[model samples]
Target chain A: MSTDSPIDATRPIALRAVRGFHVGGRPVDLVDLPHRQLATVPGLQPRVSNPNGRYQVGQLYVQQFALAAPTARYPLLMWHGGGMTGATWECTPDGRPGWHDYFMRKGYDTFVSDAVERGRASWAPACLVSEMPEHRTLEQAWDIFRFGPPEGYGAANGKRQAFQGQRFPVHALDQLAKQFVARWTSTGGMALDAYVELIRRVGPCTILAHSEGGRLAQHAALSVPELVKGLILVEPAGAPSTAVEDASRLRGIPHCVLWGDYIPQNSLWTIYRRQVDEWLAAVQHAGAEVTEFDLPAKGIRGNSHLPMMDDNNWLIANLIHEWISGAMEGGMSG
Target chain B: MSTDSPIDATRPIALRAVRGFHVGGRPVDLVDLPHRQLATVPGLQPRVSNPNGRYQVGQLYVQQFALAAPTARYPLLMWHGGGMTGATWECTPDGRPGWHDYFMRKGYDTFVSDAVERGRASWAPACLVSEMPEHRTLEQAWDIFRFGPPEGYGAANGKRQAFQGQRFPVHALDQLAKQFVARWTSTGGMALDAYVELIRRVGPCTILAHSEGGRLAQHAALSVPELVKGLILVEPAGAPSTAVEDASRLRGIPHCVLWGDYIPQNSLWTIYRRQVDEWLAAVQHAGAEVTEFDLPAKGIRGNSHLPMMDDNNWLIANLIHEWISGAMEGGMSG
Candidate 1:
């Protein structure tokens, strides 16, 4: 593995536009609330206010970075996982360019998103939401993100351990932790709706999703199969059950799933991997093109759940880009 | 007035980098807690999770877009007002180019920030925070943002009215509301600390801040007066009292304050405007160059609290840009 950063930080890139917008939420009306004072500043008197009228809730935020000239036929919509935002695709914790920059450099216009109720996609009031938001602790992130074994995160600095050959920058776990956000279990449907709305708005486009976002992308593709040109699932937490979903609908949408180094070691991932494998088999049975990359099997070692943030993230991005080119061409030929 | 959007949205720009990072937060240790299951999917079994460990809290997120060619000597830091993120400077709700796009095209490197506990800057647990978070209702926003009189936002579309000749796209008020996020009363100090840390990291810079953000920029300027080349405050909510802040320290920094229409009609802004006026007066008294633009007085009318998002936002941006050039030259000569 190379110790040097893959990206040159000072290099300039030509861009058509860097813009952002909100999509897919309806107004919810709040009526007849008693007047109250809300304290915004500690020393100042609380302002008397009314909590009434129409408020827009459940909208997703998308920030687009368009290359001057795109080689790919379709734009790429980058969706982040749970407890994370569009920042997942922006830059790695260790300051290297992540998938967004990598793919943009590869001549793809990228739309990175903050799903509904996450990041810049503001949340509704607690009463309107189905459940309270939950936060991810570092211990939980270490165990679940597969940085190391369940007990690898110890009390002291010296006690913390990464899985042998862990490609993730374990020392930068705190930096990754900074991107953790409070997510609600109830907003999955809202997020899926917003993502589908995004696909409709952008017309024909490919979706590259991570973890929780993968399932949302899967559903969005199924919802609007004609608009979704390709689906890239990176370490997805779960996939739609083959028995439940009509796999024939996804026949035109090429699918690619990428797995990192350690799956058998983690009990949770073991279950998730099995579920996805079954789902992919069902999709393939229905005559859809499906590609799977198990990193270790492919001789790419020591990768974590967040391969895009790994030391060899650029390499992984290149692999995905190559796969995308082949898949798009195959779709055209078929 | 021309109905055409002020910005040419299709233009391309050269950028050295479009990157994002987190700054200024300390790790908080979570003590012993019983293991529990977290429900992330509606139909699936909840996953067992550990809630004990170190968590990073109170950090701020900043995204930077650097121009390719040298022009401005210092970068511009854009801080959003309450209930908004860096998205405030990204694009107008009506799909017009925002301050970020305009300023970047004007040959300035721009760093737009999400303040602590807002937007990409995730909030701490309720237990860790001083007070519960609050959401702004459409009625509250209408009253405070001064789109019209307190009674302007009627329940029916036909009944609603914008103060005669309001420039804010009233039909798109819902669009603006989409950018609103839940904010905390207790996180002001944390936000200030993070803003100061950003100043230290970015070196000498001018700050362009809106509403509540204006106060934070003011304090950050006072904390590191030498690093803050200038301050552009748009409808600032509050300012440091002359009796408490040593205005002499601000003598070297040029200050610009801009106000929109209908302040007298909105009681709250009248008080806020007065405080900022006194603060600016005191700074000018202490020998700082101070410039104030009451838009109506300058023949720029029909603007609301968020002048940067108004229909004529580009015109206002150009005004600010010209002022910046003059201030920078004056600083050099003086």
Candidate 2:
């Protein structure tokens, strides 16, 4: 089922610029005197009193990939979902070019970020940071993401009972599984704060938020809708409870919610669907322009929840490109 | 991810038996008084109807592959979805060995049927047939099946937007399109009648049904539960609107409903999900051993609605084999 899809070879090679920065750093003192203990060393040494690393403020990490000869009308900013990092947009488990590269090829200045306390962002002491997410085991992810039978992925030995025609590269299940990280318990507010600050610094840009990142994206949009050129929600974790006033402010920003495969019979997904619906209706009532892409409605089947990592990730990237192009061009179309 | 999955190759090779037969045919009279016309080149060529073919009752066509050394406790009779024939189980659109061969290798005597008015079961005159489905356009199927964008499928030029991670053979989209036939508007009842008769003639057996075939499978089980040893519903289009009484009759049968990928945003599929839910609940309440495989819940992603044709189709087949083996061994288990 392979064909040489048309490639724009003549398109000018992308002139790329890359940089990194930190957001929302705060100061904190290290308490060492309380736990000091004597150590048997050649020289007199305060066992636990010595400072570990330079004491500084905690901040979120941001990586920017700017295309000098950009084709897109607006810069694109991406936020990762829970338990994930900026790597979410970098590459896929199947080793395909991730959304970041795909969009860059299409000539968009792209920025990906690690939320506060995630990835390159230095972790703060438990007291300094807000609620932290518990580490997720491989079993938990396999169950939560519906990878296969409760027995875990054994596709290698054919003990897997994965759905027929499932899109997740069963051959690469373990590779994809390796990407799942620990999710925070209640860092939404802090993440929201950092995201809004990031948006303020970045200026007006189109944002793509996946899963849990959706809450922060919504908060940022609601707080400063003027700076958000567009919002692309990929199977949002949940939407903020919004009033018409909050939503109306987002009228100028075009929004789209894209869902991947498998929602029926799964209670958790059902709830997510309802949340998306409520958000859609709420935003529409406020006169905000919104579009929903029910993949199945368009006869697109077999897309897993994490479409960006699916074998056909490039195809989805194309769809998103079209949507973003249309929205930025003053229309909301698929 | 490419680890060689374990295959029960050492299991005895099946002793196979092949047979063909017709089901539910009836007599029809030829009318000689109809309007007649003469042909210039022939001797009084009459326009009036004459006896056509051999005189036999119209019945569905059944092709059976019986294994002499059957490992499965009961025979497995398969019914294809709407607009399809027994070919649905024969081979995949991508040319891989399909479920029929896979299961036959597992030692299950398999029977595939072309429903009345479909495939080998030649259609009778309108007066003799019950109902016929309307022809579906390529556009309609493309839209309903989510093959790609509204622009339509053109694999030759690579103008397709199949869902990212879709398992469908995009390269074979055109080939698969060529196989789709017209469906009947109200042939469910007639097909059900013939299917029930087939079951009666073949004796008690397990059933594997997809899409529209769900109706006939359900009815056959409900009408004669004794004849249905086990039931495997693969993304059934809809299920029987069975009351507790109707469902209780199926208490002895172990039923499993396996949903493929992507069902959340599809409005049409929402209705289908509801129907499946209703059927599942009713059957469970009736003390029928039932199991629902929500693939997404198990992290088995990227499965299209047609698991049989998916890249991981054999994995799905293995799951069903386990379920059948468990059920036939005197108790229903996953």
Candidate 3:
């Protein structure tokens, strides 16, 4: 189960449709550049002046893969973590099928999304946006993603130490880095709004959100609890405090939180874990069914922050499938 | 056939696998900014210093959808135009099945790519890259994409004039604009190299390239003619001069160049059309089989630069499919 076997490339997938679209965001009128020359595309003669018009900004991009005969009652919406795109769920760094494929194969319609300001969810100009974009350096990703100890990356080969049982393909970390994107600091509110819009468009559905997207999923669920049938948060970077959200709104919605190994070792993740635990406790206190899986505790060891991209991703996916099946049944009975 | 009917959402698509990977690009070592505070992520206590390391740069991101059963001899590589990602081929602006789906349904393994410095192909830090990235404004897009004449956009309703027979869904222009990404001017060479690498990995295949991607596709074909089985250039924005590339290298390859309506009215497109025509003449002169489609002349009218995203996109896709089938057959016989 912990092996690095690749997905069978020849396995057939009976898909009903594969399509994509942009959702949410509002149009903003650009009136300031009345006569500004259009020089974006290189080498255009008789430069045309910028026209004052309405332009869309801060939208989300979603790619959907519908199954021919879906067994699951609800669709699965996959939201990637910070500095990543829907590509995160499309394939693993080591070139295996990602969670998007696994769930689709499980006979659930899958919608993988790139949140606002990331990937196909194109960004607004600096003037239109509230803050400048930020990029994650390789050094930062290696450390924050918990592939190794803070000092493991950029260290001498002998000194480099992946958490003893780290399952991330460290050799393919560069490939993983290729999925990182420039994100904005001020788009949290905008992103949350878009997620809610997404749920409105394709819900009541289950949301499988990772890292930064986790908080947005939680907020969206809270905002439209009826539409969000279930929630799965994996190594979420932040969480909504009970003081801020009415956790009781999630009373009937099932919740699952997953954490990989080496969390306690990272200071930032330690804080994040504590925050999420507090929120989960509040949700549980309010009568929501909460299931937590500390992978090491579950004997599924060697997982990195991005367990979906780890060597044993399918094993993890199988576990989640079981949880979803059980959770749906339990919700039905309750 | 030119109707605005949406794709039948429940149509089945059998696939072997859906996955993605990054290709090409060399590692860049960052020697500067040692001990720089890792402040990319906001609000992390005890800021860690940035670790200097080797980072991958200038790679292309490719998403592949392999079919369970294949009738075609080679795959179809879909490379989008400037300011756009592989999303261009995923779904049309008006939410119809794009060329990717059409080609895939026709039994060809399709690889839709986001070139270097675009979409999932991450960008480098300012220090690592040669130049700044450029954003396409809505005004420029409206004119250059040839939806209408220069004064057509931003004019009063009555004053705005779409080409009398424009077929692009003007109402959904904003949705199309949402797919536009910030692109770098200096990455053309890097993009070309990455595309060539992609060809090496999935070669003996056909390339369906649009706009800016057209130049890169031609260059890759010239660089490795044997690998490129066929070529489809859709309203390509630029072309390699015969002086720069020996078009005779494409001697045995089958080529198809498609143009939409209203090319004669736009000055910039006129130049691009002329350049591409020159290259096509040279390619044909070299004993290569070449087919050119002027949609209007062929009775398929009311198209735009992005014919793949136009209202009558299905008709255009049908034309390309017929051309591909004929070209492949011709290649085998000739």
Q: Which candidate ranks first by lDDT, i.e. highest?
A: 1
Off by over 4 Å in 1: A1-11, A32-35, A155-159, A330-334, B1-10, B32-35, B155-159, B330-334
Error of 1 at B112 (Å): 0.6
* Runs off by more than 4 Å, candidate 2: A1-13, A32-58, A129-132, A149-158, A243-245, A331-334, B1-334
For the predicted complex of model 3, DockQ is: 0.51
Query: Mind giving the per-residue lDDT tens digits that candidate 1 earns over B1-334?
Result: 2354444556677887778889999899877767767777544789776667778887999998878884777899999999899999988888877888888877789999999988898887666765557788777788889988766787466666889889888778888999999898667888999999999999999999999999889988999999999999999999988878888889899999999999988778888888889889989998999999889999988999998888888888877888888865543210
Each candidate's number of clashing pairs is: 0, 35, 0
Chain B TM-score against the true chain B, candidate 1: 0.94
- Report the C-alpha lDDT of model 3 over B1-334, residue by residue, as the tens digit: 3563334434577888888788988777777665643343334453545435656787899988888886677888999998789999988877778888777777788999998988878777666765445567677787788888777875776455688888888878778888888777656778889999999998689899999898789988888899998999999887888776788999888889999988888888898888889989999999988899988898988899999888788778877777877766543210
Task: Point out the higher-scoring one by lDDT: 1 or 2.
Answer: 1
lDDT of 1 by residue, A227-248 (tens): 9988999998888887788888
Kindly list the per-residue Cα lDDT of model 2 for residues B222-301, writing each as its tens digit: 88898898889988777766543377788788898888766774555667778778877888887888988888787877
State, as a TM-score between 0 and 1, how close model 3 is to the true structure: 0.93
- Model 3: residues >4 Å from true position, as ranges? A1-10, A31-54, A331-334, B1-11, B34-54, B158-160, B331-334
Chain A alone, TM-score per model: 0.94, 0.86, 0.92
